[model samples]
Target: MRKRVAVIGGGIAGLAAAVRLRDLTPPDTEIIVYEQSGALGGKLRTGELGGVTVERGAESFLMTGADGAESAAVALVKRLGLGDAIRHPARVPAALAFGGRLAPMPGGTLVGVPGDLAQLGDVAHADAERDHDAGRPLLAEGEDVAVGALVRERYGDEVVDRLVDPMLGGVYAGRADGLSLQVTMPQLARTARVEHTLRDAVRAAQRAGRRVPGKPIFGAVEGGMSRLVGAAAAASSARISLGLPVREIARTAHGWRLLLGPVPAPQTDDVDAVVLAVPASPAARLLSGVAPAAAAALGALDYASVALVGLALPPGTPLPDLSGFLVPPSEGTLVKAATFVTTKWSLPGDGPVIVRASLGRAGEQERLQFDDAVLLERAMSDLGALLGGELPPPVASWVQRWGGGLPQYAPGHLDRLAAARAALPPGLALAGAAFDGIGIPVCIASGERAAEDVSKAWEG
Candidate 1:
């Protein structure tokens, strides 16, 4: 019998799932991808600013995973024949905007948690005495805690607010107080399970994650992130159904049926297996009847909205030699992070100095409700303040807003997701940023895992 798989949500995760299904199943297996939006690559959109290719969504991904192996994203790029297009950032240090001045980010820190307490120079004060052994491990087996709560308990408020929060905000658009250690810093969390002190745990985690010397930590496609999305989609060879919403999914004796399109006139798709790769809310809605527990867990997840402001300053505009800087929420600025795109990447024939600023943090939705012009103004203002000089008006500018774009992985997020996955029925699996941790590599691995799960169910 010819097998068929339906992949809901045509983002990177869904497309990656489709590609994996194609690789695993027989050549005759049919894979179809349905995307609610008119486009693919949910948070990997790329745009042109002043004739320069720039990413409107995620700009880059970690080059290697914690084990010092090539990241899943790099592996996918190789599989898709885009290995040559990989571009590493220039070896410029990042800074933290503190008290209206840029301070070099401290060294030997795991996501802003100083592995060596003595290395935390000027960025933030750590209470070294409080980091002494408590005669027990920092975390109990299978227990989860917020990254901020754990750090604050040992290092004090300065460490969490000044160092950790901004670093986390740059990636998750979430505060450290709310994000889960297991979900965000799994390596550190694992070490904390056995290590008696927070500093010791950080040291152990850092030692475990020691990468190859002189290798760049981050990478991006030469063209843009869109190239990655396009390659993955083409390689998947799945029937593309754009701008259609999958209304409901119901299990059938033979397999599964999906109710898609509008309620007035719907379409049905029957498949041997299905991959739910959408965001938490919609995934919850579709799974409510079939997997109530999973639905409830999915519904409990929260998201953060953010806007990216890209500017193309005239060539010869003086900017810092650094790649970028992150701003602590205590700085009271609309801009949380900014990247010097052209300075960071070796773009060919760059006509203008490209800069991208990220605005808005978790639980600050109202601050991002402004129009593009207003948001751009606020971002430019913040940049000027950070740079300590008024920047010249850009020759070209762009603003991209992503509402609920980032998932806030609360404490126990991984446990909740595990239980949700366990409760799901056979022939159905979930993938994407919501189920797994965020980031391109994580999402890609998640999609591939879902593909494997459904393939096994079909084989059975």
Candidate 2:
């Protein structure tokens, strides 16, 4: 009999896993991907704006490679015949809203951690004094610490709120104080344990030749992220069932049994292997019967909700020449960050200038409760300050809300992941932003790794 493999989610991670499974397993192996939503590409969604397709979720992904090597994501895109469709961002620096005015981000900073204390100037807190005693070791031996608390102790509160909060918010949609330093920025965390100060550690790394010159760091699909989703689905050849959420799972004599669809009238599938590529909460709920310990750990994880508002302004509106600006949490604004969509990517057709505004963070979901029109108004208010004046009534507008979008990596996240993975069954694997890194490429890699894990078990 042909082997059957089941993928619980149809997001990038699940799709990538299904594709990898197809390649690793025999030709007759049957692979199926079940997605609860009507559409694929969980966060890689795109929408029409100004007659052009623009990304509603993640716009671009950071590339990873050593010098001349191609990143996994780049290789995948090229393999899918999308090599020519890759577009790099226009050269522009992002500005920081500080002291009631826009200021250029300080040079020699890594995710808001300043490499040189002298560079901070007015950005550092006025009463902030560098803690020379950071070398005394506040964290327990071999323990993780919050990124914001560590920075605040070494640098100051202003540095954490002004520089670190905005940069971390742009990535996790969570506050820096709640995020793990080791998980978010691994290299810095390692150096912090040995070096007396962040500045010293950064200097040491620079001396050790850690800089890469003239290398592009980010890439996006020419049309939209939706193209990547379509290509992955085609490449995998896995049966995709949309709007069919898997409700339950049970151990079977052959391998496993999945109960899918609504509770009243459900569908069942028996599979030799299963890959869970869904969010932490859903995965936890599904695993309760089989892996209670893993389920409990997953249930402990927290998520941050965010909203993206896309606006098309009249042509020739005087906007900042830069890519976009980030609002410091101290600014007391609903909008956290704004991206100049047209400036950052090549849209399908030019109808009007497109701008994407991001609102809400982990603890700031109160503003997201408002209606779309009200949210648009709040976004416009922030954009007005960014552009130094009120923007013209948007020719087109869209609001895409992602509830529990980003998983918060609180301190000890790595340890928790290890425990959860140890508790999972032999042929059952988990993947997604909840376990590994949160970037697009990382999520893809996580799914591929999960597929590889299940393949080994099946072979044994």
Candidate 3:
């Protein structure tokens, strides 16, 4: 029988899997990709602004390679012929924006939760007025309730509310209180529960010779994340039908048959293997019959809504010197985080600056109350106050709303994933930010790992 593989969804995860399957399988093997949307980039989309570039979803990938993310990004760039269309540095600076000022993230701080309990306490120190008590140690308050609980337990309520919540707003876009610190922040959560103090864990980790990343910042191609996905799509051998949405999946004698949608004609494509690369909810619906247990788990993983409001302001504006600011969940607003785009990128020329404020994190709490117009008004007003002055209105504005934007990693997320994988059919596989990781590199690594496992299974 001819070996054929069907990859569902056309986003980066699916795209990466298809590309990997093409390389691993023999020349006679067949691979076909199905996407619900007309586009193949998934969460990655880009647009133009007076010849300048703007992104609606992801902006960059954290580069940790000695040669830089160049190699990882090379696949897509070469595939899409966009090698020269963009430039991404090896590193970018990260800062906390508060009181209209940017402060370098404390040194030796990893995700604002140090491995050492003492360091963790220092990092959690709140603004003088907020703390009220000078030199008061900020230990998390919660006792094994959830991620929010754990952070509050070790770092204190102030730290959890102000810094951790805001920074995580960008990562999870969900209420920190509900997040399972274990699932969302494995290292810190583990340290808090298992180890006596973060410092003890660090010493143990050092003895074991484990190291973590330094800076927690990421940036992308000048054009946008689409540049990377477009390149990946080009490199794959699969026949990509953009706009061709998959309606159903039926188990077959050899493998499976993917039913096409939007205008179902009962058309089905048979394949020896399949890879579903879409988000959790969509995949769950498609696989309700194929893998009930896995589907149920997928459905259980809650995904929250998100919106990005990109502002293009006039030049010569007296804006506050800031790289970005994270709004704590305590703010009780729709906005979880905001980044000073033009300042962060240091894009040449000052012709109107660019600032992107996040309006909805896991569905706007306060920020979401108002429509785009109201949100924009309040955001600009805040910006003006923070930037030091109320500047002219924006030359252009783009409000990018994601219905199911980011996945919430409740506690037990890792264990649940392991169970889902074990429950999946031996020939079936899962790969994407939804399960194991959420970053670009993590997704790439996930695709590669899934491919290796799938290849091994087929060989075995």
**True-structure RMSD for candidate 1:** 1.0
Task: Tell me the TM-score of each prediction against the true structure.
Answer: 0.99, 0.95, 0.84
Top model number, lDDT: 1
- Per-residue lDDT, model 2, residue 129, is 54
User: Which scores greater on TM-score, model 1 or model 2?
Assistant: 1
| Tens-digit lDDT track of model 2 for 374-454 | 999999988887667889998999999998899999998888889899999889999988888788877887898999999
lDDT of each residue in 155-232, candidate 3, tens digit only: 567666656676677777876777776556545544444455444443443434333455333447666787677767
Off by over 4 Å in 1: 348-350
Worst 10 residues of 3 by lDDT: 129-138
- Give the lowest summed-lDDT range of ten residues in model 1: 342-351
Task: TM-score winner between 2 and 3, please give it.
Answer: 2
Error of 2 at 2 (Å): 1.8
Residue 371 lDDT (model 3): 78
Off by more than 4 A, model 3: 65-107, 114-145, 189-194, 202-219, 363-371
